[model samples]
Target chain A: MPFWLDAVRRFERAIGVPVERFVTSDAYFDLLPHLKRAQSQLEDAVAAMTEEWYRLVNLPSGSDVRQMREQLSRMERQIERLTKQLADRDATGPTPTVRKRDQNG
Target chain B: MWPLLGSDLAGRVGRDLERSLWRARNGLRYVQAMSRPREGATPKDVVWKRDRAELWRYRSETPIRYAPPVVIVHSLVSRSYILDLRPGSSHVEYLLAQGFDVFMLDWGIPDERDADNSFETYVDEYMPLAVDAALAVSGAHEVTLSGYCLGGVFGILYAASYSEPPVRNLVLLATPIDFSQMGPMVAAVASGRLDTAELLDETGNVPPDALYTGFYMQAPTKEIAQYATLLENLWNDEFVDAYQAMAQWSRDHVPLPGAATRQIVDDLIRRNVLASGRWELGGREIDFGDVQANVLNAVAVKDNVVPLAVTEPVMQLVGEPSKRDELRLTGGHVTFGAGSHAFKHTLPALSRWLADHSDELDSPKER
Candidate 1:
């Protein structure tokens, strides 16, 4: 072991205990929500400004790309569902349709 | 007295000079990112894949002693490499050496396309198929479903929802069952102070940065402390390599799918359904009592991520008392898979329980 290693370990412990307590404290948790809200608002504002700039320049924005992606994703999901249904039908065979005259008889 | 003082001074100076030289050399390597350790280095093959999910079956030179194959389900929010972190420190490596057939179910990083994937998508669609693929490849009648963190929640839900799931044994590592006991970050979401919808970006997934921030808030100064420890241990090459590997894994996070995030926020966090036994999925009520597999819940005593309070209650909720067991070990959350704690305590105890429950093969299968 190095000569300074012991001193460094002691210093770390001295600094670590108090910081751990402060972070785990109720006061810190109470302040967290406000910080998160501010961050979210800042992000939203920046995105909105960027979108506005894109519109003024006659260019597509991130939201436009996102919309297209969402449409594609929806189509993919529909195809998956249809494929699953077909597989299930194939496995169990097709259901027989009831005739009105046969039902009445 | 003067002569003794001079000798002591000389010794101290020499040690200080040596320390400085080691620090300089190691610091350069760290900065240049040279000789960084490789993670997930174990040899494995993808037995099955659907969308972004993959089932990896690890290869072994030795024949298997256990009958049923063990499949590991990793957490959604993080990468799966933590289990196979390094050569000697890997959990999967230990299991393979113990002569057990091992497989890993990894949920790859989600993008916009996976935004609409709900719990139903994973439980009903992906998990069953992954298990079937493992069974098909291994020619095993049943498998031991082992899950870590949120993966354990998925396993519990899957086993409980299905009438006769082909799971012979279930192992949970640092899994949180009682969400009410989870810390303030979860409480903020449950209390509606933080809107989960607002957290989703244009990509239709919760960004990795946001998830990292949540984890960071739990212990703001821990990273600084870890750096200090790293500096102290920088003189040792082995210590530095291990530290670098763990540090990289800690910072690496994956985006959570939008629909699954919403469902978890509403059903698991806010309602606390699993703890209360009121959870339902796919038009069926999920009852832990319905899980017929033998259960093992491993809780880390020093884990702040998933405290004992949150993880210990699963013993009462799942399976019969005779079939359920708990292994309470002294270490942090990642200790079950990595570090000396895993090799010394976790792997041995876990393997003993698994071997007791598993049927022995008549003869070892050749590679």
Candidate 2:
């Protein structure tokens, strides 16, 4: 093993002491909420601007893509369920015979 | 003695010169060859599929030794290809050779769309669905569920939540239980230098670059030192090959969904939820003591990310002492799954343990 690996390990251990002391202090957790709020506002502004640009171009937006993705995902699940049902039926063989009705109507 | 020394020194110089010339000639070709490192070299079929997740069953030529199929749940933070890295260095290949039908549930790369996906999405939704699919594909009623790192956290939560888990055996590789025992990254997060929720809000999903930043903070000098070692051993083909492969694997970090990031920050890192055993999902209480499956808590002793303290507590929480086993080996986090030591020592022992606990070997026809 290289001598530096031991040095790195020792350095890590040395740094942990101060980090632990700093983190567990009450002041650290207190600052979190404020940071979260500011970031949220900035994100919203960026999203709104991006959405507007995409809208002006007459192209689908992120929201539109997300909606389509969800729709396709649901369809995929439905297909999977129907495929499984068909496989199960094939495995056991069909039990009930199909009856023709309402053709006259 | 002087003449002998002189002749020996001359011979050594000649050999070094020859080796240097050889390296100079082939160095670029070697670099090019290493650049095209093939990952997930094992052949597998997609047995089950869900949104951004798939269960793959690897092809096996030999008869499966164990009846209970093994399902590996990979850490969401990175790609699952680490377990199936390459031909000689694959955990999946080793398990398959041991006559165990193996399935890997890979959570493919998450993007902004998956921002809404939370711990609930994985523990309550995708995992159960994947388990059912694994059972269906393998024709086995029960499975040996193995998880690596964050994936193990999900596995443990799932195992504890279900009244009677469909899993016969549970394996946790470098899984953290006590978040309080987390390393400097957790310390830095707790220090309030940055608000995790706000960071997640800015980017709907936590970017890989941010995750890399956190990892780098833990050992700032490690990456630089690794590069130094790589350059020093550039003339050695074997060293270069291994280093290149590992370097590529390390670089392939995945984004974490925002909601998932929030939960990890609040529930896991800050609150130390897993240690509390009061964790709830979908109004259901998840107590670690509720898990009854034969458990193997395999921890890498030298693992900096999920250190010994972070993982050791879970062994005490499990209900059955006889069922709970620990395999403490000396390696870093990812090395347990990919390193040469794992192939020779840990993997074989792990395979035997699974085989011994499983009743699947008794009835091949049933499978």
Candidate 3:
């Protein structure tokens, strides 16, 4: 119903799917590298990775696999962020609004 | 007036004028394809074997290993020799001189049985098989896959999907990626206003006249109206050669498999699949990331079948930096390939890009 949703919906309609409402899938770890880039929210990256992968493969409409992949990515990103925040609190009582990934890996 | 516009009077006058122009283009093509080689008109020989998939090879006389061999895969709608027309204007000759091996996959005209053949047959079966044969002959682990127009689209799709394709670089010339922007030719085929199945039922392969009429209808100004004017300008010999060659080539067309046409319209034009990055071929997924090789997305600034807006989307789809690059310049779709600008610029761009990025290429056979 929103304009952004409508734009994405138009794209999905052209793509012949319900990507807008579909939940993410379990193949989330495949996007680990991409998720590292988006510090704040995993939903956006998960959504992108799912929709694009589907188009590339030319899968038919309503692919449960693609949805599962997105759902996993979002959850992984969220958990990864929570772990980082908790570690950051232990290192210092209060943190600055700006956050960064620990790049030891 | 209908006859004046559609009558034999108009056709006769139009044909005569076009005959001259096709002659000039063909002459230029002959000179381009053959005149060099230092040996005169003797064509570089191939073993010439006929397989389920029709293919021909033109090894350069003075062979050089600049890149892996170049495999030319053209549209299902035409003959392969269009690229190797004569000597001067041949695309194969030019690539051979540039120090690359060349092979062409010719989808020979189909008959009644071919009507059942689908796009999957070509992408899943014909093209991949051709690549295997070329790799076996060239002994090169990777290649520069160059495809023209619709052939380019198929080439891009194939290169993207196949795992570790024996391709060093992917070249897409005047290939359409976003069919939504295509002119009336595709739109008619897409909207179901033109029933592909019914037409295929009536005729095994879609007729050449039907294809030409659709293409010409898009630019009647160039196809008919311009010829009406060119009758006065026919004195030039160059004009005569190019006109005759092009006219002959235009009328001579290969039929598209009915099933193949159906898939293309449904998946590409109607559904707008490829650009969306969800296109599936041969069971495996086809993400741009899968094609880690260098890509040269060369688009003609003025093409009708594959407009710049459409053909250019491949650049956006691929990975960054050394992975992909684009050349957005002048020339109509097919003309950019054979004419003067091609030699002056496009060939060099292809050569330089391949040479510079040759290191990033994976030669699976090398190990």
- Each model's TM-score for chain A is 0.62, 0.59, 0.29
Instruction: Say which candidate scores most in lDDT.
Output: 1
Shift of residue B217 alpha carbon in model 2, Å: 2.3
In model 1, the clashing pairs are: none
List the candidates ranked by TM-score, beginning with the highest.
Answer: 1, 2, 3
Candidate 2 chain B minimal-lDDT segment of 10 residues: B358-367
Model number with the top TM-score = 1
> What would the per-residue lDDT of candidate 3 be over residues B1-367, giving only the tens digit for each residue?
6766678777888887787776566546655743332221216544233223565667555546455767777887755655665467666777666555667776666654456566666666567656766776666666678887778777766766654566678877777778888765566557665565544423355766667655554434333333433343444556545554555565676677777787787888899887786566555556655565678888888775678888878887753456778877676765544566666776667667656755333422221
Better of 1 and 2 by DockQ: 1
* Deviation in Å, model 1, residue A1 alpha carbon: 7.0
Enumerate the candidates' DockQ scores in order. Answer: 0.19, 0.06, 0.01
Per-residue lDDT of model 2, residues A1-105, tens digit only: 558766655665577557655544555445545665677678768877899999999989777786776676556556665775676567553221211112131
Off by over 4 Å in 3: A1-105, B1-52, B201-203, B224-235, B319-322, B358-367
Place model 3 in a CAPRI quality band.
incorrect
lDDT tens digits, residue span B1-367, model 1: 9999999999999987887788888888876764443448689999888778999999889799997999999999988999998788889999999889999999988877788889888887788888888888899878999999999988887777665688899999998888888887788778886688778976688999988887876766666657777888777788887887787787788999999999889988899887875467876677787677999999999998899999988999987688899999998999878889889998999999889989889998864
Q: Which stretches of candidate 2 lie over 4 Å from their true place?
A: A1-105, B1-14, B21-38, B201-203, B360-367
Q: Give the alpha carbon lDDT tens digit for every residue of B86-110 in model 2.
A: 7777889888887888999898888
Interface RMSD of 1: 10.8
User: Which stretch of 10 consecutive residues in model 3 chain B shows the poorest summed lDDT?
Assistant: B33-42
- Which pairs of residues collide in candidate 2? B65-B99, B67-B360
Considering TM-score, which of the candidate structures 1 and 2 is the better prediction for this target? 1
By TM-score, the better pick of 2 and 3 is 2
Candidate 1's displacement at residue B264, Å, is 1.7
